[model samples]
Target: MQKPGADFEDELENSEGAEELYERMSFTVDKGQEPLRIDKFLINRIEGGTRNKLQQAIEKGHVLVNGKAIKSNHKIKPGDEVLVYSETSPESTEIVPEKMELNFVYEDDDIIVINKPAGMVVHPGSGNYNGTVVNGIAWHLQQQSPELTEVALPRFGLVHRIDKNTSGLLVLAKNEKASIGLAAQFAAHTAHRRYIALVWGDFEDSEGTISGHVGRHQRFRKIMDVYPEGDHGKDAVTHYTVLEKFGYVSLVECRLETGRTHQIRVHMKHIGHPLFNDDTYGGDRIVKGTVFTKYKQFVDNCFAICPRHALHAKTLGFIHPTTKKEMFFNSELPEDIQQVIEKWRRYVSAKGIMTEG
Candidate 1:
């Protein structure tokens, strides 16, 4: 495992930090191995492991059978590849655990899916240490077990992350093996991720792709910029489909081919439609709406409804490390996003504006 290095600290100085991956360990299930239950198979194999503990691990998706997460009773067949993995904290930083109300979408011993709300930072960075998703995860795990004596990430792990204000699904590995598996999927662009964003302008084409080189903005180093015709920065691609268009602002669903920092926001802005209310990318101002007082007030109200950027990590899908089975999860649009979208619909209706793509 490589240290995050200076680049990571620089990015976190401004964005509050969420990018993290974990170290893992793996094993293969041989034919000569135990043919009984997965827990029974792992029993006495893992250091300091007991029957109940192994059973808990299997039940929590720790012990994988042939690559998929299975229950405790799952019988390992011949030639099955069994892998066990989890994570501990990096030696560079000490993460402090804090109690928080986090929405757990799915959990097994291996990984956890969290519905991260807007305004929550995912990691402990320079200025911020406690009250982050990582902190909460540590506390949550400690509640489940009494042996979490380490102040660092003993069992806590992070595979992927979204922006601080980007609400929706995020996956975290509970151990080393799970983190490594999930990280590989994301790195290879095999993990299925879909986001819903409201942009400031209408699209000429209903569905299209945005490709560019994304990196720190030359002028505004705190934000992101795009290079259209060169190979100066990291390659980034975003595929978008127009879901609805309300004269000025439009609702879009964006699928990412590469997980770059501020990729969607930068790409959208590069194409002339910044995400609505994204303060970092010059989206707070009225960019597309009419200048009338009523229209201005309406837009302002919509902004107030969803104080953050109008983006949500709506769906996530990935191949399970142990089972290799396709696992997918979806989240509803948060109340703020949902309500603002409805407001736009009603505003367009009352104004008698029918926008044709």
Candidate 2:
């Protein structure tokens, strides 16, 4: 039997919302097949299938035979058709709704554009069950429109996600049709996304492109690694333009040609310019500053000013899924990032004056 966690790795290449939960599997019995209980039959045929899971699906009216919902004891006869609908996994049902304020940038009957704050998780996963954007949206929907809560799983139409520390604009679909429509655009690489990042070093050129394969690190599964040789991982590309130079750090605008997990973070690190104060990509330390105690203290103060990475999803543009119209949204940098930038500006100006004096 296939392993329980087996997945289509190649699908991650073009798919942005890898964690969106919905699955379907179907099978047709052979002409010579003998009668057997549907649950038993499925457990034998489906990879990583368990009788308990099938029973739960059957109880939830997700198991159908010959176009009708069936119980676990329903027998599968020769030439029978069986179908099973599921989420990402049985454990995904644990998502709970919680009341939390959401920053809705744009909202209509079909979609919602949220200006997510830093330190807020986009979805629920290991070590995070409540206090996610999804949970907050779900609760908001339930309170505003209780009828929409009838669905088995309450995702609140989240289509894509930004990192926990990366504050920016994110779009969510209000229904399945809208989700499908928006997902297609993201998969096609037609959606325009721009990010502003403060990296550790100055760029030689005003603009450039970084191309490499991004995938899970073999040694560290929690972080991503760049495969420049194209031997492994999915193809990823980032185009960047230097917006300002601060001797030890540079602020750059990054436009993503392909969205991958940690695409901006991993790509910047690949080029020796990891995002400032990004703990995961080794940006929490002073990568470009001097070795003096004063310099170290200044860098540490900067880190304290911006507790998270100095990256923001500054702009998002995409076609309206239902309206068939162009939609665009922009957001300002969070206060922490802004403060750090100002600090760097003042430090640079002071150093220039000292050198001249």
Candidate 3:
């Protein structure tokens, strides 16, 4: 379930049936790619696509170029958008609408904002194909209009994404036009997003910015890493303000400048302040605290209170695609985060050395 990348291009394809190939894969021809047969182009991109299977798919109108069915010999040109609307891989393709509970923050014809809980993945992928944000959205759309129940909502429903363990607010586009508008806003850095995180250290400065190039790690291909002085990854910026400082940890507010994958988590780790309980970047342990058994037990209890990364998407802002008006939404810290903060607050202020940002 690794994302398609330069090192490992492991994406979909299978020869189960040409007709079963659903609208699963989307690819934009690179500006530098020379004219090549559509079949050849796809076989190279799809992990297990065979020449015979692709030819069969083309005959059955499973392949589209610029939104039109094409023959296998059709030449692909630069900037041409190719889409495979087949169940090349059922898990990633089939949009099964499993009914599940979700916190609906705001809803309208063209958009919906959801206060997603932690442990719920934003979309279907890898080990989790059901009980995701997408599944819930599908069910909601179906329930809103019974006629549409038989059909799956287009992939445009998700305008942006957050990590599975990161809980917070998310705005989803209900249509293609809205998707385009919102996507442009995110790409241009006009959309605003803020997160609250508890990191494993106290900061000397009240506020600061962390900027670096974020891309796939060379060793751990699944997770992201920082390219501080290299040109291998996308440029990312995260501004953070210390909200409150405990003896061994601090509550921080992060406003993202560029929404790279895991931007806040990566930037915080780059500065040696990984989010507490974030196991991926090594924040699960007591980084700066007493070695005594009592303090260890206290930290362990806090971990149980949250049981996940101590991060939350507190605010999100964007322009309404249809209304042409600025839209903003905020969410209170979830109960897990609130309880942990209060626990630290009581522990820190026992003496008079605690400081607030």
Candidate 4:
């Protein structure tokens, strides 16, 4: 309801970033500082920031306790270290929707499925506005039904999102009933979503499950971490099987039980097999000369063409909200990813290694 982040506005006016103005304070709770909420901890530590600003920081996830972001009322235990970023004061600007092209896969009265391409951001925020998936969807919806007013623009009711760089099948609800139905399926873990990823190692088993509580990474807030079993994090389940083995690389399909942000990438990385070409989760530094060496330049060039995580929503299954019929949809790997897999296969074949089956 309030502006995205008051600190964002503060940053624009101050000219200097939050790092320059705000001093990051770290404190280990002693007997006197026993238990306190995250916001209360910030109020006591940070000097210039107001309570309102503190709340904004908490919401934006800039403030962390014990390496985890917490709500304003989150109770902090002893030994918890709190980190707060400096304030930002940027001016508010009108968000004008720009025209963009959308590849429509399926559309009906209540829902639409799109094969969102890599490099297309899902929404408008953080130095990106035009040319996003949302903008494109908005444009398409407007053109599809001109009788609908600007206020009537459904923007293709976003039910869930794949990362900006991950290309795959994404469904958008056309109305509220469909949106609620699909969202509930995701919440209940009934919608079967599967992804295909080329990771950097040969897993031990033909199939296995990785389950853990998923929370934000301790140092890099953008990345998710597989936390020790606990309450603050939600249970994430990933079932993976190897379709083919390429010595140092393996093509695998992963299915999720809980749809947390970066669930597959985080879980795979936790088990020592980060996605191929993934930089944040440790796929970028994979030994290039191994399988993908001959086409290193080509692969690098392709990565630049679509600088996204090398994961795709290969298959999706759910019951139709209106028809009540079980439905499933799948997309082949994108050209860039397909090439990576092909090259790896060639390398493995050259070495006389057969498919894993």
Candidate 5:
């Protein structure tokens, strides 16, 4: 959501019958407060703001003490200036319909599944103000065929999300009941998800599993790290098997035992075999030599044309939300990724390398 700027005060004053309130706090540590934690002090001083909220504010770099943002758990000394700025929640905007194409895989009264192409955002955001998967679904529902029911625009129930760059089978619910049911399935780790990926490595073993608690890196927001002193992290499990192995590249199938944000990407990176062309996580190894470097230009062009991670959601299965019948859906590889795979195969074959099963 966009942040309110200089006009925030005027807009707040002119808001109809409602006033947004903000409180600024400042403090100086006492003689005995030398060892007090910054967050603790804020909780003690700010009325109605809990330690959790204060910590969130501080970690988000919203808390300034002596004109510097301090860590939530940082110790406070005898003399320190503290400031806190709070704002009202931004007004929610109704998702608008856009004339975008959608590849509908399956649809029922309770749920809908789409073969979401790579580079398509699951929802709307700043850089993507239109042409989102949700926007397409909204538009499609508006032009519902006589075979489908009249569903409301701006109301496709999304249970979870894939990264904007990940192409996959995505499920949406038709109503709140289906949404809640599918959400419960995800929470319970019973929903099945499988992905196909190309990684920059050779694997001696055919299969393996990765299990760990993943959290955002302290220094690099884009990277995830296995945290021993865990914060808002959860245990994630991924089972993978080698499908094919080029001398320097391996095609792998990853099955999620527990889905978390960037689970496959982080787990593969943690295993020292990050996905091919994943610039954010050591993808440089995939384009080292002169031949691969020349090939890399074509790969990069394809990626830009596709504009997404090479990962694809290959399979998804779950029980029907209303009928209780078991359901499953699988998608063939998108043509772009298929072509890349064939090119890699040719490169390996020319070198007399045996492809892995």
Candidate 6:
């Protein structure tokens, strides 16, 4: 017979979606054990777990018995097995709070808004254990709420996140009630988020929308792809308006109706206008410019100036968790993006002059 939790670990290693990151623990009931509610049994067996947290895990289908999912009320019999999984992976090292600088765009009793720069990971994971936004926030919180020192490590109030290469504004809750409230807004798609992207090609229309199901790539798990037939993945929608045209490339503002991993990057690629210099989506090449050596060098220079995807989370809006008041925040483009845009403008002007000559 298979061990109680071994099956779950195997399943998680092969499962899709959020479970991919989960760390699992399993328990086997003794042969002489009496019938007991799974949740009640787990409270005694699992150290430092509350009935409420375990119940929530059960409700989310993270708990299993005898290699099958079970509810909190399920009765465990002698010879039965149990497994529990948490979304976060088990860390070998402790998460120490680093006193890093944070660009606070807005803050109050309930929440804190941060202008995250490119290259800063939102949270600690795998090889990146510190120097993340979460670490900084933990230090800030420890200072603000000295009580937090008594809690567990890696305790963060983050509700949503942006990519490591994508610079932007992000909001995090300071308390559990605030976290729950912010999460509901995100789940309902009521929060407003707008991104500015410099894409490879100009659009015929000034504004448009891209609708597709966004999910992980079939072969490459690291990247996302669009399912046009809606056969797979979750529904994602992005509304874009052309802000400026540079002939070969255009600047556009994209408004997101739904948030998914790499949604903007994948959708833009689907429309044949991958973000300029986006290394992952084939934007690092000269997608729209001439093959001339001079043009190639110019494009290469632009790539060096930006060194990452030309996308910025320019604006964010959501309702305050405590005050229930509407809040909106905006950020200026980083110097690298601004410099690359200027370079494009000059390149376009020189090209026009050559054509006239």
lDDT of each: 0.77, 0.77, 0.77, 0.68, 0.68, 0.77
Reference-based TM-score of each model: 0.76, 0.75, 0.76, 0.69, 0.69, 0.74
Name every residue pair that clashes in candidate 6: none
How far residue 224's Cα lies from its native spot in candidate 2, in Å, is: 0.9
lDDT of 2 by residue, 1-357 (tens): 112333433222212223223345779998998899999999988789898988977876667788677888899998888877554422345456788889999988888899989888776655555688877877777776788644322443655667777889999887766765665566556789999999998777889999999878888766789996668877888999998888899999999977778889999999999999989899998898667999899999999888998989999999998888999999999899899988988998988822110
Against the correct fold, how does model 5 do in TM-score? Answer: 0.69
Off by over 4 Å in 2: 1-91, 148-156, 353-357
Q: Write the per-residue lDDT of candidate 5 for residues 220-251, one digit (tens) a residue.
A: 65456665425555677889999998766788
Tell me how many residue pairs clash in candidate 6: 0
Off by over 4 Å in 4: 1-97, 151-156, 287-307
* Per-residue lDDT over 232-270 for candidate 4, one digit per residue giving the tens place of the 0 to 100 score: 556778999888887777888998877666778889999
Off by over 4 Å in 1: 1-92, 151-156, 355-357
Give the local distance difference test score of model 5: 0.68
Model 5 spans with C-alpha error above 4 angstroms? 1-92, 145-156, 229-232, 284-307
Q: What is the lDDT of residue 257 in candidate 4?
A: 77
User: Of the candidates numbered 1 and 6, which has the greater TM-score value?
Assistant: 1
For candidate 6, write residues 1-357 as lDDT tens digits: 112343323222221112123335778899988999999999987888899989987875667788666778899998887877654433323456789989999888878999999988776654455788877887887887787654233342655678778999988888756765565566556789999999988778889999998877888766778996558887888999998888888899999987767788889999999999888899999888678998899899999999999989999999997898999999999999999988988878876732110
**Taking the tens digit of each residue's C-alpha lDDT, what string does model 3 give over 174-196?**
87667655655665567899999
Give the RMSD in angstroms, all C-alphas superposed, for model 3.
8.1
Error of 4 at 115 (Å): 0.5
